[model samples]
Target: MARLKKTVAMVGMMGAGKTAVGSAVARALRVPFLDSDEEIVKAANSTIAEIFERDGEPFFRARETEVLGRLLRGTPCVLSTGGGAYLAESNRRLISEAGVAVWLRADIDLLWQRVRHKTTRPLLRTDNPRETLRKIYEARVPLYGLADIVVDSCPDLSVEEMAGRVIEALRQRPDVLEGE
Candidate 1:
């Protein structure tokens, strides 16, 4: 098994396959896998959509920040965050201090294709979801570029292939991953 010296944070726009790829990476590394959105849902006893509808985005974001901070302080693992998590400067700082953030860079069209039919994304519940996703992608790209590593995602790649790409990226940073 590879030795993960720090948490591997998966940060990117929605439909970038953070959770799916992060899970595979954790499996490959023989480490635990954590998801910030899942943690928030567990704590709030509500689905993300429900939370967004009831408590609003600000409330969910606060919970997300708290969950992220707590998780980043824990043992090294693969941590997948919500799409908007890295948009906050404080969350980005926390991740930088405690973990290595990897941006799962996928094209906007690919992201739209992946998430277009998914009703779970509260942010995408717009009249024109494709356009909305494009706007979101445009806004978040710069923020994601600040990550410690970048793993490009292609429509042709399988989940395991994406995970392998992330692992390759992480291996380049010896401080983040060692003792393979």
Candidate 2:
């Protein structure tokens, strides 16, 4: 079995396949898969959209950080975070210190295609969601670039294929993965 030395935090846009690809990566690596969003939802007993609608984004963000820190302090697994998780300096520092951040980079169009029909995204509930997504993409790319590794996403790539790419990228950092 492949040994994971640190938590592999998957950071990217809303539809960048972080959860799907991260789950596959964890399975391939024989590690657990933890999603911050899911954790938050579980703790609050509500969906992310509900959390945002009731308590506000700040509240949700605090919960996100708490969940991330809690998970990172536990086992070395693949952790998928919400799109805005990496934007906060505190979150970035926490992730960098305890885990390795892998940015699943996808183009604006691909991200839009994947998320356009999803009503779960609270951030994209604007008058023009595509434009809103574009703006978000522009703002977050630099922060996402701060990740330790970057795995490019393509429209043609399957979730398994993307997971394979992440595995290859993790292989470059022997301290992160062993017995690859």
Instruction: List the RMSD of every prediction in angstroms.
Output: 0.7, 0.8
lDDT of 1 by residue, 61-173 (tens): 99999999999999999999999999999999999999999999999888988898899999999998898898998899999999999999988989999899999989998
Reference-based lDDT, residue 58, model 1: 94
Give the per-residue lDDT of model 2 (tens digit) for 67-137: 99999999899999999999999999999999999999999999999999999999999999999999999
TM agreement with the true structure for every prediction? 0.98, 0.98
List the candidate 2 regions with Cα displacement exceeding 4 Å.
none
Task: Kindly report the root-mean-square deviation of model 1 from the true structure over all alpha carbons.
Answer: 0.7
Report every candidate's CA lDDT: 0.94, 0.95
Structure candidate 2, residue pairs in collision: none
